[model samples]
Target: MRAPSGGNGGNAARLWPGIGGLAALVALWWLATGAGQAEGLAARFAPSATLASAAGLLRHPDLWLHLGVSLRRVLLGLAIALLAGVPLGLLVGGVRAVDAAVSPAFQFLRMISPLSWMPVVVMVLGVGDRPVLFLLAFAGLWPILLNTAAGVRQLDPRWILLARSLAATRAELLMRVVLPGVVGSVLTGLRLSIGIVWIVLVPAEMLGVNAGLGYFILDTRDRLAYSELLATVLVIGLLGFALDTLARWLHRWWVPS
Candidate 1:
């Protein structure tokens, strides 16, 4: 019989970390809630109660409304990153002079965290999706740009030399070779950026959007509804996990070899 493919085995093995983490969380919830470590957690950790609450939230349209709003803002931000990151990366990556000129400025800006920009973003863009989206895109771009540039720089010089020798047009080389060559790095950057985006989603949405998980968090807190707050937190974690899973799947399925 033939030996098993390492690729398939590796794929199967990769899921254990998530599975292990989730299992540990559930175990801890059971332990902490059962131990009566907190005043209200015992009731909150009752799976039946939590499940019922989750079901009730699902039945209501408001939860969906909150989710939709958050999704829209995050998606809009990701789209902006894609639009601006790719070209900027290509320009900086493909040219030596351009890279040298722009690298310092980009590095300086990248060192600044998205949260640091909240005040400026709010003041400049005003309180709405614009500032939130702007921050998300801003935070997400540096990785994509840097990764894409690295990808370009790492490309086999022989390929470009061959292209020049073959008299391949500029557009043709970019379209056929450079783009495909760098897709993996681009996707890697996208994955990292999405993680950042996920972490900041609730905070961004909390900026008085009137609706979103963040708003839900504030409402629950103000009402002292810890169960609802916990539930929302759970939802955020699950959704972020889902996004990461999706990104990984896309990287495997669609990224150029």
Candidate 2:
């Protein structure tokens, strides 16, 4: 039989380590739960129970509803961030005067935790999806804004000069030259923003939203459904993983070598 190629061997070498590590972690988790003993909270929420709960949840209609609500909130928040951040980033990055004026305040506000604004947000937007959206948008905005601004700053000055030399109008310059140059940075920001938005979505959903993953988690805990709670956590992890993978694929597609 012919030996496997070096490329295939190398790929297997890299892949197996990750698979092994994950397997080790799962083994440790199961062992730590005393191998499915019926005693203790750890045992009650063992990996097997969690997996079973997750399987059961797949059959539950309410799970889909919560997932849908959470997905909607995340997407809406990201949309709001994109609409606001891109323009603001363009203004801040393209104009030195605007950058100097806004930089200090923007940095300061960005450092403050989005959760700190929860009370104020709730008061301003009141209960329901609006407040959750505000928080998620707030969480997502800074990364997008900063990355876009950085992209703008990194753009080749020659491109702008060439456009200007051609007597391109300001609108044409922005549309044809500036926007394309910054698209990679904008996508990077978007990837980061999605992760932030997903993280914030759960806590934001805890506010007044009747339907969302966060609400389901709370409901599960209240009803003493520990296994279901673990299942929810697993679901969150899986969904976040899938979203990040999609973002990465999009980035690669947009900025191919």
lDDT (0 to 1) per candidate: 0.84, 0.93
Residue-by-residue lDDT tens digits, candidate 1, 1-257: 99877987786788788689888977777676764444564677555456667778778788899999888888888889988998999999988899999999999999998888888888898887788889889878888888899999999989989988999999999998899899988998899889998787788777847888888889888987667777778788888888888888888887635
Q: Which stretches of candidate 1 lie over 4 Å from their true place?
A: 5-18, 34-38, 45-49
Best by lDDT: 2
**At residue 46, what lDDT does model 2 achieve?**
90
TM-score of each: 0.89, 0.94
Q: What is the lDDT of candidate 2?
A: 0.93
lDDT of 2 by residue, 74-190 (tens): 999999999999999999999999999999999998999898899999999899999998899999999999999999999999999999999999999999999999999999999
Worst 10 residues of 1 by lDDT: 32-41
Q: What is the lDDT of residue 6 in candidate 2?
A: 98
